[model samples]
Target: MVRNYKRKTDWTEKSKKAVKNGQTIRQAAHNYGINESSLWRAVRNVSAGKSLVSLSEASQSRIIFFLEEEAVLVEYLLKASRIGFPLDTSTLKSLAYDLAIRNSKRSWRTQKSAGKDWLKGFKSRHSQLSIRTPEPTSIARATAFNKTNVGPFFDKLKQLYEELSLTPERIYNVDETGGS
Candidate 1:
């Protein structure tokens, strides 16, 4: 297969190293096999205290959310997952649109929802996260009460109850099929 993707951080460190060693941008570019224009831009950005890794070149001009905005979205998704209300891609896209609107972003105001390309980039950027389909359970496995897992679970629950002195009114259960 022909390799079409540009390596995002390919010359980030090497370019920085060469510049720090007092080499010119052209010299760094030649030594590191990076485009001279790219090296020049990186050097300017580095001098201005910007990140050495070029987000624009890394994303190949497809990025919408800035690094900070993306970080906020990531934190929101993670928090939702921890609380057991994971958002699917469609909902996430809608939420992104909403967030952009609420933040008064003029550029994103034209978009109804985040596009598939944006979603693809988002997933690629967060490749460490695993998105998987839940396995279908057998009726026997579902019905069979597994004492090993359940016993400790309830024990922890009881422990929490005692520690917190929780009332019955404070406890509420949520299931997957329940309506919002």
Candidate 2:
């Protein structure tokens, strides 16, 4: 079951605006309808260069990695995915450990690898990416299907179709022979 709640104010945005205008945390809290303590914390974080929006909206649960570090990891993951070399969870954790070591994140140095909780947070933060079971196929088979055969076939088929001025609605490509 899902519960929907209406927000009375975007306290973060209001707090930021108030701080920028030289209002005290207490004044900002009263003006923006945010808890005084939470607004004070938000002011402190904002003073430290963390965005109020992210502070307010992001999950309050413990996070092992910093935002910039996680962003870099996400970039690597996206690039790997584009190159058809997406990492599984264990591999991603290992990579994250390596990243932490390279970036000299002192807290993470004590751990062997990022925990399952960290992985869950990372996944939730990145909604566009999904964990999927890979199809059962050899690397050689997949390479051949994608690089050796499929590309040339599509290129030639496209050339011939354009030469014949085939209408998209009427034209269909179907394999005539089932796999032996």
Best-matching candidate per lDDT: 1
Backbone clash pairs for candidate 2 read none
lDDT of 1 by residue, 110-138 (tens): 66897777677677789854434435679
> How high is the CA lDDT of each candidate model?
0.74, 0.73
- lDDT (tens digit, per residue) of candidate 2 on 1-180: 112256666768768788789998788788777789887777778779886554335544445578888889889987887676767888888898898778876545666788777777677779977655455788877777756568888899899889998877866435532111
After superposition, which runs of candidate 2 have C-alpha atoms over 4 Å from their true positions? 1-62, 108-111, 138-180
> Using TM-score as the measure, which candidate wins?
2
Candidate 1 at 88: error in angstroms? 1.6
Residue 95 error, candidate 1, Å: 1.5
Q: Alpha-carbon error at 102 in model 2, in Å?
A: 1.1
